[model samples]
Target: MEVPPSPTFPRALPSRSIPLAILSFLLVGVISLVILPHDFRLQEMFPSSCTNGAAASTSGQLADAATQPVVDLRVFLGVLTRPGMYERRAHLRLAYSLQPRPVRAVIDVRYVFCNLDKEEDRVLVAMEIIAHGDIVVLNCTENMDGGKTYECSPTSPTTTSARPTTDTYYRLAALADTLRDKPRDGLYHGFLNPCHQSRETQYMSGMGYIVSWDIAAWISAREELRHERGYEDSLFGWWMRKGGFKNVYGEEPRMYDYLDREMGEGVTCFRHELIADTVAVHKLKDRLKWARTLNFFNVTQGLKPSKMYDVDRLNSNMYHV
Candidate 1:
């Protein structure tokens, strides 16, 4: 069999012109590279511009009263924390970020920490501060016996307390109700220490507590508090006593510890199973506890339905199990 003449196609670039075209393309690329900004970096070219601010939405996101209705009050809720507990802080951020904003109120959540001793923390924490704009770096050494919480007073007219793993999960609505009912100065609201001397002399437990702006300002004013050496909470109580500020409000079972079912043998007044209408739950201590606590509140209730997920099953397995 004889083959017919094959079809021929013209070349887009002739062989003679190919080298010149290649050289021109190469030159253009080189010129483009050279003409780029001297300090041109990928980060600068495609910068991640993250604006940190409270969003105004009832969709379980962090929000302030700025974009809402008339503001009745502003509460600075500072979480006393350490530089090393990054995971704990992340959990807390998620926990609070998913909470509904209190009506006519602003609950500014800030992470309060002592001086950064570690090099990694200095870098990482700085990044966090820049990213979140919700960190308070105190100028004292970190220690429970030291005046870390005391130092947080002068920083802001804020309520300083710890969070899960010494963290607290509280209902903002319940707290607002409590405060609205007792709108007065010299307010020291917390779980009263059970073994304390009397109602008049008793101190709030260290799990968590809240001091009104007046009480915090009073503590901040006393330069002598800087020299005091004792348990932070106990010292705070002593100061309350010294100042004769007797507007102490105790929330015993209302604000108690996370009750582990296995270790439910001997629960104290401040340690037991969770309850509805809770002002706060303490001793969340780990991720599992936090999961349970968050699940109890139905934090994910507003999540849009999707066939891509079986969140109910995931929740039951992840938390309930």
Candidate 2:
């Protein structure tokens, strides 16, 4: 047993083994550093792994980009939804006369509401006398179907083409011109004629009066939401109601609230204008004077008088006396 124990295997040399073990550990550490994708500094040593990680990151970035929301210009304009509170504070001007025989005169009025708080948008309006006196009402609702009821058999057509197709902007322009021409009939029977010297006079005149109304537009958050969620049945519908879609009445209340919040309480008027035959220089001059005076702020400077369809060349027939 003692002889056998003397032959026990000799242990490896500590110096050589220690060096070799240290070298093996260093090699593994270097290999891992080069192989790992997270090692940015060492990535150059393993281009494939680095490229894969970069590609993945790029794909993630692309996905995020694709999911980002887009901005809408219509929503920026309050008209996209119900009128905004800022619109109620609009400033309006009224100038009228009852002289020059035939009670001919002009009513010039102008105001800036909402959108114009920053910049102006030109508004070209056109209007035709619909009715007058007790029988006439400013049917601001161009499409008669709005407040009217249609009687039809169950199988009858549900729609009709009797309603007038009027452009709101052009109507405003026309109204502006009419207002510039004083002694014009009032568009609405109950409304006080801005041209009348007093409320009593306006009521008594029965002469009918002209009016000019316009609004500065701004992006409407409600409208934007409606467009986004028109088909959805959730939060968007709730916002649309708050924004004014459910109300059957006109936007007067909304406009009032908007103005009250922005302009503070003050006396305000909503007037209308009309268009005139520019061939009559004398009348045109007078009308222009009224327009300039009423619109002293030049709020209509940016309005486009003509649309794309109006590009046709004018002929002699277009001019009048």
Top candidate when judged by TM-score against the true structure: 1
Tell me the spans in candidate 1 whose CA falls farther than 4 Å from its real position.
1-69, 144-165, 195-197, 318-321
Q: Local distance difference test, per candidate? A: 0.53, 0.18
Q: Per-residue CA lDDT of candidate 2, range 104-215, in tens?
A: 1111111111121212221211111111000111212222232221221221111111122110111122222322222111111112223324322222011111110100
lDDT: worst 10-residue window of model 1: 20-29
Off by over 4 Å in 2: 1-72, 75-294, 297-321
- For each candidate in turn, the TM-score is 0.72, 0.14
Candidate 2 lowest-lDDT run of ten: 20-29
Inter-residue clash pairs, candidate 1: 163-166, 163-167, 163-168, 164-167, 165-285
Let me know the TM-score candidate 1 reaches against the reference structure. 0.72
Question: What is candidate 1's lDDT per residue for 215-296, written digit by digit as tens?
Answer: 5556556666656666555656676667655456677768787788866556766677778788888766667788888888
